[model samples]
Target: MPKSNVKKMLFILSKATIENVYAAFIMANGARMEGIEAEIFFTFFGLEAIQKKKLEHLHVATVGNPAMHMPTMLGGLPGMEALATKMMKKEMEKLDMPPIGEFLEILSDSGCKLWACKLAVEMFHLEEKDLIDDLDGILTIGDFYSRATEDNTQMLFV
Candidate 1:
């Protein structure tokens, strides 16, 4: 593989579904493992992953998700999302994947920064206390942009 020039990764997560959140988390974790600096900016529905009360309760978004391979109507039925999420979690557990909260802690302890989008936080009427203890802070887009002062920094919207 060619050596990567990228030294930093900035992820903007805008969805709350377990799949979307996991995508960001896994990429950030991979970056850290590769000695790259990494950060996640939680925005829109993605803030749910950071919310103290909601992170553990995140479910797979079954409805209207083509990848779920179920009819939209069936996916929207009561308990369908829960059943899918439960099955996914069981599979994750079998692979020794840590739960959301634990994954956040691991990322934090590994020096990956986690930030909540200020606008989204305000829109949701959430206080700092409502977020995980590992959160670095809430930031505006400008503030987040400033963090990429070095060369070879990459931004990704997930």
Candidate 2:
């Protein structure tokens, strides 16, 4: 096969649900594995993935998730979300997927840039200490866009 033209991948994660967070993580990791530059911009609720305390407690979105094959009412029941999150975590463990905290470390060690959104940090009243140690730093949207100024760079929102 011919070599891929893509040189870099930029991912914007705006959701905190475990599934959405993992999607961005997996894709960015894949890009780095292929020797492509990768970066993740965490904004809105996505910041939870990079928070020191919240990362470990991220849960699956059981309610209103049609893929769960359950009624919305059933999903809303007490403990349903916890149960679903538990099951998902078990499956992820089987697949050798690391938990959020370790995964962030791996991404950082592998040279995948992790940036928190400046506006979101301010809105959430978060200090730098509130974020994961692996985070590169907080950045404005314009600063993030400037990182994408290379040819064959691609951006994705998750």
Candidate 3:
């Protein structure tokens, strides 16, 4: 047996919320920068980030989150999710942060693998056409575990 120099990381993202989705990308990109091999498997609500049909529906929190406060009840209305997302995007832009889609593309281009969970796809009735084109493939949990079994590999659930 030989020690492997490369580190393998499996990131499981299940939340579609803005911060959670962004955090997944941040971690993936960071891992790549550290010379680690990283794979992200989007499942459940997290699928929205890679699904063309649902990508635009991603949202941020303007209210009810302990860290944030809504100035008025109207600020927390049903349509406010979009507003909050937009506001957050603008703030990120000002900070020169990469958009979620662009960040994912960069990660793929840099050799980090992206996968959509097969069980989630079937459960949501999602077809291949629904996913972003950058995904390396659709994988089952067993498939992911097989890859993550290598020495020094780390698995994360978010």
lDDT string for model 2 (1-158, tens) is 88779999999999999999999999999999999999999999999999998999999998889999999999999999999999999999999999999999989999999999999999999999999988999999999999997999999999
Q: Compute the lDDT for candidate 3.
A: 0.85
lDDT of each: 0.96, 0.96, 0.85
Q: Residue 148 CA error for candidate 1 (Å)?
A: 0.6
User: After superposing candidate 1, which stretches have Cα over 4 Å from the reference?
Assistant: none
lDDT for residue 115 in candidate 1, whole number 0-100: 95
Better of 1 and 3 by TM-score: 1
Tens-digit lDDT string for candidate 3 (1-158): 66447588889999888899888888888888887889999998899999976775678866667565656566677878787788898998998888777877898998989889999999999999989999889999899888776788988998
* Maximum-TM-score candidate: 2
TM-score of 2: 0.98
Residue 14, candidate 1: C-alpha displacement in angstroms = 0.6
RMSD of 3: 3.8
User: What is the alpha-carbon RMSD of candidate 2 to the true structure?
Assistant: 0.7
In model 3, what lDDT does residue 74 have? 61
Give one clash count per candidate, in the order shown: 0, 0, 0
Runs off by more than 4 Å, candidate 2: none
